[model samples]
Target: MKRIRFVLITLSMLLLAGCGLQNTPEFQPTLQDQISLYCLDHEGNLEMREESGRLQGYCVFTDGSECAEADFFNGVCKAGEIFGEASKRGEIGVLSADEAVEVEVNSGSVDADSGSDEIVLE
Candidate 1:
């Protein structure tokens, strides 16, 4: 009887130990961690969110436009566009001048009697 009780107790303890091991904490990265990793791997600033253990967000431009939607799972960006219209705009200049030119324009006078609001550019 003593040996049977000892064996049963030992088996129960072993089963409990196995259960504890199964419940060990998993190394799941948070939204910020995923974003940091994404930024390091990719270019530009990206905003991220975590949903059902997956990270999702959009790469935003300086003008506050949605460049692309990024979806990351297990710390990997599975789908998204890195650069969009904003990046293209950055590459292309709006105005190009061969040489610097000086021009003067009226900045509006504070006093009606005095015309001293003229701004001179050099």
Candidate 2:
């Protein structure tokens, strides 16, 4: 019947549209955006500097007696100890290696404070 054919065509169109949506790429936020949101949520702040083509930085949570610091290079912290505070805070959970790379990339954006030769996270 004509009605049956129309209904089948409509359902087919709907199914094709749904399949197209599933294949569409979703937007992914940059690592810096995530860090900024986390800092805002946790009352934390970050300071960083680039020296001799290396990035050094730290993050502190004002409301908690916890902090993290590292000298990042080649997608990993030089000393492998940057996430101590992150682990203690426990909200962000464990960071993967890729996230660590993101952190290093984010640090590349900071300008060194004037006349400050060294930044101590402690």
Task: Quote the RMSD, in angstroms, for model 2.
Answer: 15.2
State the lDDT of candidate 2 residue by residue for 42-65, as single tens digits: 455666667569764455545333
Q: What is the TM-score of each candidate against the true structure?
A: 0.31, 0.27
Worst 10 residues of 1 by lDDT: 72-81
CA deviation > 4 Å runs, candidate 2: 1-28, 63-66, 69-122
State how far residue 65 of model 1 sits from its true place (Å): 6.8
Error of 2 at 6 (Å): 41
lDDT of each: 0.50, 0.49
Which candidate achieves the best TM-score against the true structure? 1
Measured with C-alpha atoms, the lDDT of residue 27 in candidate 1 is: 94
- Give the best candidate by lDDT: 1
lDDT of 2 at 24: 55
